[model samples]
Target chain A: MSIFLSILALVIILISAGLLFFLALPPKRRSRWGLRPIPAFSELVRVLGLSVEEGTRLHLTLGHAGITQPTSASALVGLQALERITAISSVSDRPPLATSGEGSLTLLSQSTLRAVYRLNNALDLYDPQRGRLTGVTPLSYAAGMLPIAYDENVSAHLIVGHYGLEIGLLCEAAVRNNAFTLAASDSLSAQAVLFATTKQPLIGEELFAIPAYLQTSPAHVASLRVQDLLRWGTVIALVLSAVLGVFGWL
Target chain B: MVMRSPVATAIAIGVGLIVLLGYLLPLPVLDPIRRLFLDWSIILAAVAGLVAILNLFKAHWRKISSSRERDYYSLFFILGFILTAALGLLFGPTDERVRPLIMSIQLPVEASLVGLLTITFVVSAVRLFALRRSWMSGIFLASTIVFLLAGSGVFLTSGTSQVIKEVLAALNILPAAGARGILLGIALGSVLTGLRVLLGMDRPYSE
Candidate 1:
């Protein structure tokens, strides 16, 4: 079983790498890969424009996941959200704010902010303080984010990361301020809670689709395609396994 | 469009691949190298924590100094940080006084937050129905109410009928199934993200 799983894993890697190199390398094809609309992202774009025009900041938080942890994939998505939003709204007087729970994530968020600003030639306006480490603990992290949600005149909140039930408090803070809250998390518990609390709740793998929705790059779009194909493949495998189990063909 | 930090990218990709190979295959040659990399990662992570503290201070300092956004409350953060760091440095993490002092403050605060979460959850459920009153919303509210009752052990009493137990058991599978579906998607995403990082096809580390 271990060897079989190992082979399967290797095949996935090969497939991903192959698709990335041959099928998805061209930049022109990026726009042609039509994506299904996620309502939250649509709302996000609309809210982003409102924020810029109304001169209010958009706050993006990467929930408490350290860089070395497996949950960091969610943080990566959060950073992508930050990058895209900052690129789009770098001209706004109030630039986007990114808050994170973990230390390495804080530094990374700062780096991403600087990179985006530089890319847009708004380097002089870039501030490291824009990316903040709210708190190390879950509840404290949520508490730390409340000010950004409430006091910062934030018009929109983008929360895409690994989070737990503490996300409820963050959502509550945003909702209280009447901010447009779009929250997604890798954690099941967080998603379940966020569905009700957040204005726009991103479910399951929808969080990973942020970059593609933002039209960041071809790689993001390609990865979304890869995810779709692999999801179907996994569904098939599950069905086959169930059939094999029922028939005593193990 | 192009690699902003080619050297950094190459190093990240190489280190990632080596560490990945170490975990995947039981190659003796790679184990020590992997261990060394991991130890280095731990040290770097600790340093990163220190950097975060510095950043936290810097951010709060700005808030305190800003004329319009003069958050004098930030003085509390700066003071608390200094005290905590001094305590931790004077006596190691395992010191008896430190744990009690930290937890004494953390416990009540976290407990209050958790308590507040329940209220938030209830309020949000009401808000959800108020905002979107559809068939799906109805079903969601009904299920949530049912689960809240079930969770409180109201349905598990001796007076409850066999049918009730059986139905509850069956309904429980729905959430488990939903959870599995979500987990599968997250796992697929993690796998894809990992590959992207390892291959250096996606670099969140820089532009």
Candidate 2:
């Protein structure tokens, strides 16, 4: 049993390494892995060019549950969102707006925005007065954000992280306000439930794909490949287990 | 407002130590201290909740007073909040009538508000197709549509529902696997993030 366990572990590691190496290469190169780069918010500016007028405002939220998420994907996505928003907003000549559900998220988000905005020489765009404490309740924060979504005439709403059923309300509000919504989360159950409800949905590991998509950081790319390898390994394991069980080999 | 009052600083330090000791120490002597701090924390949290209630009041009052559009909703919210607060406070949690009142008032109102919110999301989902298309959108669109239809108990109920079975089977596989993967991922991420917070790699807490 110990030897078998070791072999299984070794198999997983080898596959994972192969995946990482394959994904590290650009899409143009031929490799065993086929990792597609998700477009970053920064690329949006380059593609459309910076709309220096009141063209579109991007509203982002770090979902409530992601604050306590074991994996920092929620927070990482939150940071990425902040960086992307500020970078795009700076050149676009519009203040990228954001709202957060948790107190900690609100604080971190604001800080990230400030840091990026300062780096971009758009310090004035950074609202120094806003703090982390948005509100205590889930629906209350939703209620608070609705007016901002409406009044800001926001052009795009990008929601990332772990969310709940109540998030649908926020999405709906964005839709009603004529803003395009892009939401991504790492939870399967929530994704299962929310996919039907959201105008834009991101399911499963797709939420973690943002960092790899934008920074093309080796770590991010490697992590994403690791996830994919892990997923496929589990699938193969399940199939083998089922076959063995059918043959009375259990 | 003297700059950084010493007494306030001392109190903060004292509270901080108590909280730390409560979390870190399991010694018998510290148990009572921990319990006392726990009780105090609850009271403080309730007071904090009171402050939140005040903020809510002020926000709604301004809206109503200014006679803003949809101000009527604020009035209803205020009334409901007040009613719940009055019942919860005056009768306390043990009040026999409180449950019924809560069910009658809180249940319906919260349900309606949340329902309205859900309906808006449905409308958004319907209109989303006109917006953009990408793999992310594709996954979101497929998942959402299936989730809603399945959750509503409108699918796989009739005899001629091969489509529902295929959809449900596909959806079910991802969720279970995704749930396991996500749980593991979250556990690892939380540990790293907590370390970052503790080590001050991520700190908005300080200026």
Candidate 3:
């Protein structure tokens, strides 16, 4: 079983490497992959433009996760949203705010804001304060976000990462504030809360596709395609396993 | 644009490879090296946490002092932070006094927030159907209703039909199945993300 598992891992690695190489090729050589429209991301583009026109803040709220944990990937997705929103809204009168519940993520968000603003030649707009460590604990984090959600004149929010039921509190606040929110989380309970509360909720692994939707990066496309392919592969495996089980095969 | 520093990437890849190899091959030599890398990360994380606390202080101080956005509520934040820090420093983290002092405030606040979540969830679930008129939303509301009833004495009664009981039991399994699917997807995504970081295809840390 271990040997078979090792072989499976090797095969997946080789396939991923190959696909990434091919898909991430220069546009001159290979056409970019077309992604299906997610209503949340589609609505985000419209909301972002309106946010700028109205000069309202865009709050990018990340969850309580650092780079060391498994939920770090989800946190990175939130950071990607932060980077994208900051870059897009750099020209706006109000700069975007990135809030996180973890210290490392707070630092990373600040770094990300700085880099993107600099890349856009809007260094004057960059402030480390734009990236905030709102709170460390889950409930504290939600409570910390309340004032920002209620008082920051924020019109739009990109809430992503790993969160629990506490996210519902943030969502409720955003709703009462009449803010447009695009929320996603690695936690199942958070996802359920988001699904029920936020009009734009990215479910399950859909949280990881933020980069592809937000930016024009070949690397993002490559990884997304890898994910799509593997997801289908998993579906096939599950179906085959069920068939085997029905046939009394081990 | 992603590659800010190859040196950083190289360091990440080296440490990540060592850790990956230690997990995969279980070699004695790689194990300690992996442990050392993990220890370094933990130390760095702790320092980063300290930096976060300072950022929190700075942010609240600004809110208190800023002319336009003079949020007096920030004074409470400042006072609470100082008190917590002083207590933690004076008594150490595991001190009974410190734990109770923190927990006394934290537990109730958190519990109240969680209780508020129940209302928020109820409202959201009620609003969910209003916002989304799709079949998926219908199914979601139906399942939610079913589960609520099932958890109550509605489905588990002594006089309930065996078929109805079996149906409710099957419905209970559906959430577990759905949760598993979500978990599988997240796990795949995480692996891809970790692989990208390891292979230097994505430089989230730098870019």
Q: How many pairs of residues collide in each model?
A: 0, 10, 0
The pairs that clash in candidate 3 are none
Per-residue CA lDDT of model 2 for B150-205, tens digit only, reads 66766666674787688778877875675786666554343333333332233323
Per-residue alpha-carbon lDDT of candidate 1 for residues A28-74, written as tens digits (9 for 90 to 100): 75455689878878888999998999999999999998988889999
Candidate 1 lDDT by residue in tens digits, B124-178:
8889976556686788788888887877888898899999999989888988998
Candidate 1 chain A weakest ten by summed lDDT: A22-31
Q: Rank candidates by TM-score, best first.
A: 1, 3, 2
Tens digits of per-residue lDDT for model 2, A1-250: 3556646644644455455556656656754443674443344444324333656666677766534334345755666645655665656645666566554556556666676666666677666323233345666666666766776557776777666666677766765675666667656545644565555466555666665555524445555666755666566877899999999998
Best candidate according to DockQ: 1
> Which digits, one per residue and each the tens of the lDDT, describe model 3 over residues A1-250?
3766856786787688788778778878976668898988889999999999999999998899888887888988787778778878888888899888998889888888888877887788788998899899988998999998988899988998989888888888988988999998889988888888887889888888988888746777788889999999999999999999999995
Q: Compare candidates 1 and 2 on DockQ and give the better one.
A: 1
**How displaced is residue A219 in candidate 3, in Å?**
0.9
Off by over 4 Å in 1: A27-31, B1-3
What DockQ, on C-alphas, does every prediction get? 0.69, 0.12, 0.64
lDDT tens string, model 3, B1-207?
342777878998888888877766646898898899989998898898899889899989998999997999999999998999999999998998899988999899888988988888888887887766788888888888878888886667678898997888887899999999999999888887777778877766674
- What's the TM-score of chain B for every model shown? 0.90, 0.60, 0.93
| Model 3 chain B weakest 10-residue run by lDDT | B1-10
Question: Roughly what TM-score does model 2 have, to 2 decimal places?
Answer: 0.60
